[model samples]
Target: MTWINDIKHTLNKKCAGLAACALVLALAGAPVLAPAQALADVRKADVVYGQAVDARGLSVAQCPSIDAEYAFVMDKDGTVYFERNATSPTQIASITKIMTAVVALDAVASGAATLDSTVTVSAAAAAVGESSADLQEGDTMPLEVALKALLVPSGNDAAVAIAETIGGSEDAFVAAMNAKAAELGCIDTVFENPHGLDDGEFAGDQHSCAADVAKMAQYAMKNDTFRAIVGGGDTAIVVNRADGTKPTIELESTDELMDYYSNAIGIKTGFTALAGPSFAGAANNGDKELYAVVIHSTSEAQRFEDARELFDWVYEHELDYRLANSAQTATMTVNGARTEVPVAAEVPHTEWIDKTVKATLADPEASVRIFDLNGNVSQSLEFDEVTGDVKAGDKVGTVTFKQRNATIATVDLVACEDVAAPDLLEGIGIWWDRLFRGLSGQPQVASAVTLNETPLVVDKTAVAA
Candidate 1:
């Protein structure tokens, strides 16, 4: 198909002028349109709404003109707000460093490294790529400084240096990054380098989908150190060299959004000859944030434009398509006994359900056996049949929602009871005279029995049948 046709198919738009311009650029191998200019056009397009499209359904018309590849926009809650071919893996360019940053910060949080800890540069790290922090062999800097350079300048050298500092080598660090991606349920992502420089031979295996990148971005934003580094606009550091001379380097952010969008937070951008321009960016509109990923754009400018279009689209429409509150009520069965556990949230809770679901009862059946905190199944409890009054937070029962029969969502069966526990001893005592009069063989007097210096008096008599 012609490039124009591809653009038309990808964006589902019949913009003759824009399509012709994109087609000419693609065929001539020219740079894609600038993001700032494209976004100006998009603002006009938004006012000329074609129709009320279903937000749940995918639409190519909403996507901007770029090199056709995977793209997606996700909300803070992990719900996909917009997507097109988001599952397909593609050359992600430097966006891979988003994962690198997340893994580095995680290692630091785990005490594997510290922000203030200094790391010596090695020859291998210095040799990674053109986008470098200009480190010489044996040059040293703190982890926090390196991260600012790596993210802000898109420094491949800084990525390699940090990897080696934390994992002993870039190879070991890539392994840790991949392992962490897997742990976070990024199923379609893989990494061969800490810096995300494309390796031609392993192109197929060394890529991530747009959705996977969004997930990684989400994970990184949760770290205080990672957030601080990415959120900064620029950083200045003294670059120490092996020859005993130091040069100060001013690293500026590659994320243009930091300059243009008032609420823009920090993220990463990537580009290569083969991969084109790919970007993963996030912005906060109040407590709610949105992440946008665009892969394989025709030019660097186009990538940013596509990302901005996505951000603007989400900002305008996300609340309209916000997921409604969903709930699942389940019953627990053990030792042939059953109890109901209701699961709910005060607000609509939405999450990407990728892993196995699990549930545990706050109170398991007395007859049911489970392990203690130490992992030994030493205690057994019979299921207490739920009865009487219950309150909101009261533990009526415990339930775990499972995927592949493994627990994921847990909720307590709360008592609806709003009152205090009933007193059984305060009401009345039983009569002993009625208990003795019914005897057939002998008549015994009712008496209070006491011992150990306590007094007891009663009428005593013996009778034979």
Candidate 2:
């Protein structure tokens, strides 16, 4: 009886293995019978499956009561993960400081100004708003310190002061802000005032699209100085006094999301009767990070809630859209010789395919195209002889992935060499060809060539005899 029970258990195990193998073969579009037969002796096993969800299926219901006019959620790469009316222009409230901070930081980075340089507060900046940094007109402080006060405290006074220092006056600063926005590719944005306080006319108030704000944020975060300033909850600065009394001023961040969301990074928030509540929040969850813009919410809390929801959706679904079975290569010409360049992805290569369906590579080499950040064709090399060496991170070629004629994605190709040069003869031949090519009718050929035979040399004595 015991032997019979053992035989039954072994048969159950065999059956389970067969079922799992069958499922894998079906998903892979492989020969199903082979896997089924291989696993036929197995029985019980645990298996997991992934289901495909369409955009609409993943989208959350709109929040009507929040009174939001526009909202957007973007991945770290500036891809719009989700959005609603994100392109429409709307009053952005204090989020205008994001632009202000970016422009000011740009000035410092370009050597037009320095963060430690002092700017005397003007009577105008001192009186700009009720929430002043208490900066007296005659008082001065380092630009870096003032920026922290402006951003962290959301001080209207500090905004005007920084604007005056950078733009010569608040009005001039507003013009500069608008110009900088255009430079930063914020096409739908316009800034009439340095601070986001509502102007009587909608035109007077600072206005921007959610998408534009997200772009600006992405650019600003690239600046190490700006990133540091924005990521902090508060900063302490020394204020210069006329009476020989030094005072320390503490600036607190207005963004409540930083305090609540563990992964939340530094961004900006704004509010006004006309603009309502607006917030730009950035958060990083392990490998994936996202930015959320909530514009014109009924209340501050509601905007924060909306931003959180957007981040949650991003973290949950980011892996679903990644590239699968991706590969990269770099090609470069050395000394007029072409060589295969090796390349690597900045991030790990990964993809999540639907378990119900199988994906296959259509072509090995023609599937991708590569380009530089400026959209220039990547450098590629061809040679007649052996391929030369290439170093990692060296620009070699580009890969562009396409379905039919439409492009799906682009990646960079880099050299795998630590250091390399072209073959000696190839290098000399390249120079020699270039020197004579201008005089000859033959068009220039950029590809490298390998020589199979040495050129003949005449002997002077033999020629004379």
Candidate 3:
């Protein structure tokens, strides 16, 4: 009793008008003292990355050192994993065929054209000197057959045929290609021709970067038709002509990566003096698939080497979600009273216990980017002042994880415990907490009940006799 009296005496002297005894009675269950004014500002947790910051001591996959002037890697979801000189645009060589193939495929997808539709090879298409499909002028074959010629052999002639047949001209096809690249957010890309030939009059201007090329590859592979075509590396098929005569042609993949690498998939290859050597390729292992780009490598073989080195490593090492690092219970301010909420995912993160790199499924500051592969995934904090009662597991805020500014995952911040509405006395305590914190230069944010300040009566009922 003596000690309590002494404490009351000291509080009365410090807070001249606080009415210390009254405050103690009102705030018996009040939250810890913080200035309610501080709630006006937002609070964010530090989003830590790297091996040392991992909640669980799991060794992450190491990044491979690639030797190429331009290189980029991404997952199947267009999440860029890594890049070197990815922003600088350079002549893409045969990687240009990806856009050509996409436009042609879009035509088929939209019912504007079909695989069985005839494409009459003109002198422009047939007379292509570099990497020809061996198509003769005036020959007519299925558009599907021409695409095989274009993609498998990396034929400039097939590009011309697709452009002329589908787009009605090469210039128009190039325009469409540029439009598609722009639409896909390829800011540093420009298509001056359907074929990635640097030997043309505008050789220097026809270029793309590793990042842009990765986007094109990702968009193309999502389609079943395009995926099947590229996945089937080398094939021999009979191409029927308009006259009913069918000629058998042997189509070989120009991308050697598919030939030597176990799970390598076909994409496109390019080379010319200005562009050096380039390849946009893909690979798959189990459930993971990646799109890789290497441009301006020292030699043609070096491009494949760089791609394989990246693909094999990325596919083998993937990040998985583990348990939440933070506690399951969380506190929220409601109606001037403190409430608790329970949080959980549909499946316990422990399911990924067997994974190599375990990440948090709950309260993750940032989405694990899967080593250096899925570009950068980050989240913005969402904290707004809350009032009124709340139920357990009720959503309060969110941590939105994004890649390339596109939302990939959103973790709902929910209540782990219930917060009941405050009565009139509690409301006085809340307003008093805010007023005290304001006078003391502290955030009026409530954590636990404190009896240091006199209760404020925001409503008349708070002081009713």
Per-candidate local distance difference test? 0.60, 0.60, 0.65
Sort by TM-score, top down from the best: 3, 2, 1
lDDT of 2 by residue, 210-274 (tens): 88989888887888877777788866778887776778876656676776788888788777666
Model 1, 169-282: lDDT tens per residue?
A: 888999999999899898688899887766554345688888799999988888888788888877788866778888898775667667677778978888765566678888
Clash count in backbone of candidate 2 = 28
C-alpha TM-score for every candidate: 0.57, 0.58, 0.61
TM-score of 1: 0.57
**Model 1 residue 219 lDDT score:** 87
Model 2, residue 224: what's the lDDT? 80
Q: Which 10-residue window of candidate 1 scores lowest in summed lDDT?
A: 347-356
- What TM-score does structure 3 among the candidates reach? 0.61
- For candidate 3, the lDDT comes to 0.65
Residue lDDT tens for model 3, 1-465: 112222332354457556677788789988878755311111111011211213322222234445577778888876555566777878887788999999998889899999888888788777766666667677787888788888877767778988999998888988989999999999799888888877655446788898899999999998776777777877775655546677787766666777678878778777777677778989887677889898887666677888987787565445542222334434544456654433332211111211111112234243332443333454553532344565544554555656446665666555444555566886677677667767988744432211111111121211232
